[model samples]
Target: MRDRPEAAPGAAPAGVAGKKSGNWKDLRARVLSAAVLVPCVALCVWAGGLLYGALIVLAMAGMAMEWARLFGFGLETRRGQLCLAWAACVGGTALAGHWGGALLVMVAAVVLGPALWAGQVAIGCAGLSLLWLRYMSEPGAGVVLFLVACVALSDTGAYMTGRVFGGPKLAPRISPAKTWSGSIGGMCCAVLGGMLIAVMLPGALPGAVWRGALFGGLVAIAAQIGDLGESALKRACNVKDSGTILPGHGGLLDRFDGLLVAAPMAALLSLGAAGGIAFWYVGLH
Candidate 1:
């Protein structure tokens, strides 16, 4: 043991050097991916028609492919499975006007995949909900955007809080880095974001304070669940990410995994008594 050669006297330890190099690579990839994706998403959302729909359909297809890949489905199996999943997602949006029917379709989508019924269902429903919100009119559009913002803020809060506090792990087996501190911080941020949205959207958002508070907190919880669920799946599969399409982000699935469940659940709760699928927004009032 004493005869074993040591690293150079001034050199960084191998583990430390590898970690630093990996972190820098991650940071660079994240920045690059965000730079391209953020603007494109913003523009498509702003356009709010065929442009957005097309992009969403493409994304759905990409995510479906990724999910299939995770399960080690062969090429033929994935081709058929992804095609069906993609169609189900887009087609179900047409039924969002009838919430029951749309939900039924999403339920059915749970059966149409290579493996992991849970993920298939969530992804399918996400596509349907995105289209529904887009076509639900101005208020729906705003709510969708607001939801995205809240999720983003929640993620930011979690990241900052977890890093600073570094307390008990949230799910050490699946996601070693997350902490209870981070989860609470994310919920707090979501609550604040919800209140702000209510003030700005008024009639379009839940009118009551309690409603807004509940909505935001619930959405944050859902987002966290979605994130953890993906992490668990990745761990089980022994993969770093669902795909490699998004550079630093890993895959489209990785980027939107949180939204896959959160968005639809939020929309479900926001349904108005008047049978409006979309919550009321500023212009509508």
Candidate 2:
């Protein structure tokens, strides 16, 4: 090292070593996070019957708890009632085996009635519950998977697009990270994901690709709204992350916020549209 140039007076060897150690630590953390996330994701994807349903139920329960925490509702008080109401709704849908007019009526009555009578918390819980029920009662595995895929794709696209092509912020107050370019990119990705899912299905693509694209675009918008809604709650509570249940991911609620909104809308659309895009496409068709 040609007598090894004298180390800078302020920059000790320890500092350089510390920096390398910090990098290794960060790398280890990321690797560990992926190690856990990958297996869990694989399990959910491969096991899509009762196991998947159970997972969904657990996820909804966890999300409900997180929501209650975010809103400052005591778990012993309002949360119990909320869970009960949600259970009832899910039970009703499962029993009926059809999410048509009856399902909508039940959800509207429960959510609006409670909002009008009990309070905002009641309404919020009911709304979330309805979304959960819709997610649970979706007809086929494929449609449910498709909806999830769209959300994932949208999120991924939005993040990448926003990072690479910075633009006007979508909502500076609610979520500074969100951008108009990201929103458009997310919508595009969602549409592409939906079309790809449709093509993969067994039968002829029921709804036109354009229709699926429109639905996906709408879902992307709704997903962002949902994300912002959750962010608002987090800001209100003065919490950085929801529960820190996941290593790198915040919490179950953090992960599923978009899905919570998108799933129900997709379910509703599937039920209404004539195209074989319904959740029950597998069973009904």
Candidate 3:
């Protein structure tokens, strides 16, 4: 019989050994990541009404804290301010009960609050306010759900496409992982997801199917841009991960960066197309 090729140093002993080792590592990491993600997803998915709102509020608060931390702000002082400001903005939306103007005001507060404060406190507050407005003005829970689905699906598609196709990099400096093939795949997935949601929730959202598709495509592009923006920030700070909050996800900011930008834009488009009557009554009133 022919002699088998000699194994290299540090290599697995046999064919099965190498495969088994790789599988085990992957399984372990996935299991650990799932342990944290499953419960959080369930909580957001199953929870509804006030409970759901509360959970979302809490998440926004957590995200605000993370954002401040990323920007070099202290937790103890900035955290509380951020949480309070977010609560106030969300509360304002709740009080408005769907008022477009009120929702706009809240969004404006989020963007301007940071600049106004000109310090850690202001930045934290502004972050929270912006998040609150995002939830308030979107096409209700349905639109919010759709935006989340599209953003996530796009990201997933992009990763898979990039890995499998291995084309030219989209932006080598900002994000090495991004590829042109991946970007196209991601946008296609996003548009499909948007169309699916629009079909499912007819009365919940206004505008034609084509509009929805167009919006989805735009949001997909915007989300990708937002992701790159966050990556740039992390790189500038010379940090590996935003935080150790999530096992595989990294941090709240890491996961929500796309959502942060997409949510507000989706909301604005919905209001503009739908005429804000519903939002005015539900969000502002």
Task: Provide the TM-score for each candidate, comma-separated.
Answer: 0.76, 0.66, 0.66
Give the alpha carbon lDDT tens digit for every residue of 31-119 in model 2.
58757865775476446555555555456556656655555554577554564355445434543455464345345544434322222
Instruction: Identify the runs in model 2 with alpha carbons over 4 angstroms from their true place.
Output: 1-46, 73-139, 206-208, 275-285
In terms of TM-score, how similar is model 2 to the real structure? 0.66
Give the worst 10-residue stretch by lDDT in candidate 2.
Answer: 1-10
- Candidate 3 residue-wise lDDT at 8: 27
lDDT of each: 0.65, 0.55, 0.55
Give per-residue CA lDDT, model 1, range 1-285, as digits (tens): 000111222344457456334433455566687788878887887787777777776777677777777777634784547554655554445543565665565566545543655555667678777777767644656667767767766776776576556578787666765789889888888888877775676354446455556667877888888888877777777776777788866777777877887877766655542445334222233
Q: What C-alpha lDDT does candidate 2 achieve relative to the native structure?
A: 0.55
Considering only N, C-alpha and C atoms within 3 Å, which residue pairs clash in candidate 2? 140-279
What is candidate 3's TM-score against the reference?
A: 0.66
lDDT of 3 by residue, 237-278 (tens): 566556667655567666667765676565555455434422
Residue 230 lDDT (model 2): 66
Lowest lDDT block of 10, candidate 3: 1-10
Point to the candidate with the largest TM-score: 1
